[model samples]
Target: MAKNSGRGRKSGGPSSRPTKPLWRRIVRSVFIWGAALGLLGAIFLATAVLFTMRELPSYSALKSSQNGQMIVVRARDGTELVSLGPSYGRWLSYDQIPQVMRDAMVTVEDRRFREHIGVDPIGMLRAVKVRFERGHFREGASTITQQLARNIFLNNSYSWTRKAREAVLALALERKFSKDQILELYLNKVYFGGGAYGIDAASRKFFGHPATGLTTPEAAIIAGLVKAPSNYSPTADMQAAIGRGNVVLGLMAKNGVISQDEADAIDLSQVKVAKEEGQNSVRYFTDWALPQLDLLLPETNEPIEVWTTLDPAMQKAATAAIDNNVPKGTQGALVSLDRDGGVLAMVGGTDYVSSNYNRATNAVRQPGSAWKLFVYMAALEAGYTPSDRVVDEPVTIDGWSPQNSGRSYAGEIDVRTAFAYSKNTIAAQLGNEVGFGTVASMARRFGITTAINTQPAMVLGTSEVRVIDMTRAFAEVSAGGTSVEPYGITKVTTTNGEVLYQHKSVQGQVLVPHYVAAGITDMLQTTVATGTGRAAQIGRPVAGKTGTTSSNKDGWFLGFSSGITTGVWMGRDDAKAVRGLSGGHAPARAFADYMKVAVAKRPVEEFDTKLQLPEWQLEPDDEQLQGDPDDYYYTDENGNLVHPGTGTQYDEQPRYDDGAVGPGPGPGIPQVPDYGQQNGAMPPPAANDDFLNRATGRGTAQDPGLRPGQGTGVVPRPSPSPVRTSGAY
Candidate 1:
């Protein structure tokens, strides 16, 4: 029993050796296993580092690689118009960079940037701990060097392998270059959104100044963009950018880079963010010129200088004219073409940023009465003079009865007078007489490529046509019947002074007879002087046509001087009619406004008007015509009927009024004498020949001046000769 007590005491009591507790044993095993795994992880990371370093780019390659330089567009005088590329400004050095910018960058991007060789282990561990506590990876611990490594050498793909490669590259970069050199390279290559790369370009683009002139707050704002440039763009969102800048300022103070008092002194209100000038103003012209680039430079990586024909002053004037004249919510486009078809200015729409659909070049709409130029040209080509008389009365063709806008008819008028009033009835009648096919052919001859219909309605300007084509056609007319193909680019050269391409002017074909063109110009002069296009007069002898569609959906005024031919179109894009809008109103007014400024420097030149007209076709004496009744009807030397009442002559009977009643002989004019057997008896109808001769105003077939019923047994006592008006006579 004593031996058993001794053994129990030895087992239960404190002895020389004591068994370890379960918790402590488990802890020891875990520690040992953890240490082993940690060693293995370290070995794996080192091996990865070795492998990645082997595949890394050489330092020389990194130093030589550069972002693409901008392709600068220039004016004819070599003035820079705009830049197109990734980097738009000069490179900035570390010393050129503002100290506040450097501090803000280092504080917000990497606090231990100076202390870390490349990767910050403390930052990484902290990131890992925070991520683990939050149950997911939500924070980044990449040092500035790591970011530089990725940006310069690797793509921004998230993966352990990529991250390991980035770490290796960063480490190699640290050993290869000093911290200042790395930071300089990073600052020079970092993208600051808005197609702006590098601190210099970002500074210039946002503040309109160099990076060396950045204020403390501006530097903070720029540095804050390192994380998300687009979200913190000063031009895009000022409040968000300022808030981010305040955060960066706080970080700078906390990191001992700046004093708290310095940060507190920064008033957010005093931070004047630079306003970026909208680059979309030239978008239309640039878009039109883009296709020419391939022909200009087939293969070039260096910056190429493009000399364009765009006149900035005229462009501004055109834009302002449309903006001021056209009603709100309605769009407008103006295109100015010089004598050689160089596009001096183009405003495709009111706001290019809102809609890039180039109305000037792409949109096709009906030209309304503006299309009458083609119709009248066709008539002239078909042997109808501008002085030819056409009765302006309602008529129907192919079951389509077209009427005048106001339903008021000027019974008989000359073509010139008809066109001046934009008489739709007369135009339709002329189109019918000349044939729709002939009118369409004339339009095609004038450089109109848009499909034209041969229907009677087409004579009233019912077809859709592009504004550019219309302008080109008018340019042809202005060039005295010579065709013009619109072109913009003049020359392109590389930065190394190598001429890539140069424009060669091509002579266009003559599309109209010179005399006919001059006659047309003379007629159009009357349009601007006292006609529908009166509003388009530019204080000089200007000629154009006013076109208002049937429902006033589209308004257009295509005019030209000797120097330039411009076309203005105003309407809604969706084809909705703008109430009270007409070609003679807004479009004509806009044209005048644009031309007033456009021709300020150009010498005033009159149109060529040497076409001869018969003496009888000249403007009638207004005093004698109202008093003398015999001067109303006569024949000119060319056998054309000269009518003083209508201020025109005709080679044939007015076609539409052939069967209508005519006014009897006027006062002091000879009357048809009665020749019936009885003195006052009605007579039977005469033979067809005699009756036809009398009806056509020719002498009766029997005798030269015999009465209508002389031989017949009919006594026509001049049925109370109806009151004769000038229109009827």
Candidate 2:
């Protein structure tokens, strides 16, 4: 009936279409709702499984950051001169940890640290709310594990990804390790500024003690530094550091770790904030010593402990000498290398803490007269004896005229005296007599490896050389002519106590005997005795040379005792010429000062006695070899030669033949064969001389062919061969 009236009637109120079969409808409805429920149940199950099985991520493993142990430096007398890095951050077990330090860390950083798992949900939610309000993460809600993980594994950069990574790592770390393990690591990993890296470093850097030795107030002060290091640094801001310390104390008091009355009673004024010296520890030494260390021990990458030949007392004494002795505008470096090439002490610059450039090893300045040693050595080896004389007056060579330091010369002096006085002309003359090649070769033997221009001017100290090179050369002289390569590290050890490497002195022969070295040493001693190096003379036996470059631009003092060798270089850091400064002034004084202190405890002894040598061969007089023309030439010994052509014999006499007695003790001139007569033959033997012929038995007593000494019998000779341009001897 409704269908019949559909055109005029409104659509059926509830069911316009034909209703589906009851069973089909019911089944369809049940399938739709059931499929939706099944899908929801599967998602819930997957989420539950994920929550149960998921594992947090791990972080980069941190081996202990505490590097080396306190290296002790003692004097030659076994007296402790200085102690370096005395406090090492040690990871302590729960039982060994001091209660006061633990409580201070807990009270200051995290109040409910022990009660929480690895994270604090409420604290994180609060941080999230703050971040939402600020539109960025301005504050942190890191749990102790999270903070420790960040401190040890990550650097300070605020980011969501890093934060999430830190959280994952912290959760993993907490699951794998105990709370005490995390806390102990955190204690050792945190930075306390002022060159302090860990709790122990902070303790020593701040309180002049170890973490285990920290008092309650001292612990609070150190704990307070973790918040903002530079701001809470006692040296930088004492008032703020004290306020932070007081706040840490109040927190400890409120947490029942310390009594309120006890905290209030504590006087911050009496708490001595021991100022850290902040030694940018041996920056210069580190720079200079590393390359050498690498050479000495190249097998491993671990740092080698260079128990250098550095004498701490000498180092202090040297620093003081440079500070007190050098002029206001100049800076200097002083180095003392042991006979074995160990660096006993080094002051690379005026102050290593202030500057890192090592002028002593790195600066290549003109060596001045110091370079003359090589020149003299070359001359000596090339047959120009040290006793040979040379004029010290100015002489031009190769269109270059070199002048002495004072523009005056002491003429006609021996090599030793001239060298002691640093004569430029005599050195150049000797260089000319020998050759540039010989001089350069000698310099190379002395460890001058870099290119040295083989000019005659080089003999006058015009070439540039570094102090380390000269020091090694001079040390070899001190050690008896044995060339020693310089070394810094004695040994290197891994963190696990395994020996990675050790250094031994490697030496080579540069001279024939220790005597030659001793002679050189003796000559150099004269340099200190009566020459420009007189300022370097110490109470004991000392040998050295002083060098002042042109216009006094660079000053140098190289000195050595029985056991140590030192080189001092002084100049302007900018290479600008300094006025009125010479090696005799500040560098020599610095060398002397350091030597006096460094050698105080060591026993006084002469050089190794075995190095001394005896005299060498001496040549004969000149006149004896150059007297008469007849001495060098052969002539007839008899008065005349008889000619048999005529029936009556005719006398054949030379025109120049007079009773001159010529060169020999004879009545007439000794006969020399005429050019045509001796053209293809060796000359006949002298009238009264006994001669030996290696090729034939013709002249000696053992040979039957020899002529008699006086009136004589005929001597038989060997068969002759044609002579070339020169006759056979």
Off by over 4 Å in 1: 1-69, 87-277, 612-729
TM-score of each: 0.54, 0.53
Q: Residue 576 lDDT in model 2? A: 82
Write model 2 residue lDDT over 1-729, tens digit each, in one string: 446655777776776788889999899999999999999977875554345224423322353454333444333334444444424455555556678988999887877678776677877788899899999986568887888777755656788888876766676676667787778777777777754667877877677776777788788888898889868877656788889999999999999999999999987767886654645324556556645543555444343233444555666787787777787788888777887787777777776534446777777888887887777766555544333455677677777777877799776565557767877777777777678788878778889866798887888677888888888878888877788777655655544656666666565666535545655665576677777788887777777888888778889889788688988888887778898788877888888888888788777755432222233323323322222323233323454433222323223234343655335324553443354544775433222122124123455454221112211221222221121110110
For model 2, the stretches where C-alpha displacement exceeds 4 angstroms are: 1-276, 280-283, 290-306, 493-500, 511-516, 601-729
Lowest summed lDDT across 10 adjacent residues in model 1 is found at 711-720
lDDT of 1 by residue, 503-580 (tens): 899988889776567667766777887788989988787878989997889999999985789999999999998998
lDDT of candidate 1 vs native? 0.77
Model 2 C-alpha lDDT versus the unseen true structure: 0.67
